[model samples]
Target: MNQFTDKRKGMDHKDLAVEARGLVKVFGDNRAVDGVDLNVRAGSIYGVLGPNGAGKTTTIRMLATLLKADAGSAKIFGYDVAKDAQIVRQLIGVTGQYASVDESLSATENLVIFSRLLGLSRAESKRKAMELLEEFGLTEAARRPLKHFSGGMRRRLDLAASLIAQPPLIFLDEPTTGLDPRTRNQMWDTIRRLVKEGSTVLLTTQYLQEADELADRIAVIDHGRVVAEGTVNDLKESIGTSSLHLSIQNEQSLSKARLIVERVLNVQSAVTAEGGKITAPMADADRVTDLLITLREAGIQLEELSVQKPTLDEVFLSITGQNTASNTQVKKEELA
Candidate 1:
């Protein structure tokens, strides 16, 4: 059995892995994390989704005990972050946005160093290092210096190092941010495996699809506050039951088609920058037949049409009141 698997006895015995209420962090005049509340269930993956500077990282820092909350309280596995920091630290593993591995060390050397520091014997450390490297698909490059590793390779190694002990609760802050599609899929599988092996994951990510795929529940933060929180389906239902997306063959018919859509569906429709795409929320998917007949009568030729559950992208836009535009003017919470 692997070292992590051997140590998994009763790791998921607790019910709540992380609990935070009114978590706040201030940077001078800017309130980085403002009154954020989170309850992460044990042995499940919980996602925190937000655009940049929305305090996702700051809130994570507070929960991980890396930053003291200006106001509010947090606990990991029922141990208070402020009062029982040492104990809390022993129960959680954290992987931040950047890789924390040493640039001069080989992948194997880095993992072995971490395992040894965590009190593993020399032989066990070496064995565990190779095991992790192979799992992360880094065994071929295990002997290469980190300086020579690509960004994705470094990120995978960083996560591998953090899993050497496989603490009960793991805080992954945008762990797959810059990874390519293939590596991201691998990371997703690893995360699922971690939870399956009796670990709870508190993940912070800007990628909505990642949350939709991994999180049992998600909290959407905006302007340092949670604007929405629920399961993916719950959040989608909050906006509408279903979404209608259609495109006309002619650009000239775009405005007329959108008008018919709103008139028939009795809802606001959003126009895309693309040729003739129009999107709208549908409370009753049955109304689409009426919309289609109305459009046909108006001489609109549809190039494509689809009625589907609301996507995470639409949920994010609806909740945040804007697309994921980087606001350089906002007092970024990440500022030192």
Candidate 2:
């Protein structure tokens, strides 16, 4: 056995499918990923979330063996990422942020070509290609050139190509970034199917909803380090308190409503005149009924009132002090 394979055998199978310790990357003077660590459980979907330039792509590339880190170590199924890169490559598949499939080839041709490149026999390649096409609901248009396919179709093909070798680990970088809602959901279903089939996925995305929906665990990275890591509910609970949004009938009513909410709930409240709205965090859910009663008794008419949990977007903002979408756009521009 090769030295890489030998080292991998030393680790227990139940250990992480992918693990990184004190991972750091530097470009000139910029530290892309600084002191970051990750532990992705076998067959679980782990999401790396950040705005653009937050080092999410850099981390993914390093794990995929496309980039070497300046410090720290990463392992794929017990194989060192830097020292045993070849073995790591064999054990994982990567789908980059942008579609990498050749536009001139038909969808089936693209998958078949990749399967063959991975050392499948001609017949095996054809069979695998057809299977992937059917699995992704692309069999109807398998013979059409990729250039004619919609953004969603092309993305599905890209994912199919990555799985030609059926690698145990998959790296998906911003897999659904520009896709429409329907297409995006379809991709989510495909990812779930992969996990069900015992594939471990490491996904990076700018979409908070996507991460919440697909990831078994989430790590929020900023400025090249993980700022928060946990399940979606765990992260939300850490932020503390649920927000109550009230749309009062008029600006005057909004002002009164905010005061009442603050006084009765003993919490901070803010009122916006333009929207005639009052928003505040409620420490106790039991206070909701009292809040309504208090508002009505005070002659404050509310057009709408609702209590909502903090969304991932809100969590990102609270942790990083910036919006995830805006940061992602800035990073894209920089990369372009």
Write candidate 2's Cα lDDT for 46-149 as tens digits. Answer: 99987778899899888999888899999899999999998998999999888889899999889988998899999999999999999899999999988789
lDDT of 2: 0.81
Candidate 1 weakest ten by summed lDDT = 1-10
For candidate 1, the C-alpha RMSD (Å) to the true structure equals: 7.1
Name the lDDT of candidate 1: 0.82
lDDT of 1 by residue, 33-79 (tens): 88987878898899998878889988988888899999999988899
> Who wins the lDDT comparison?
1
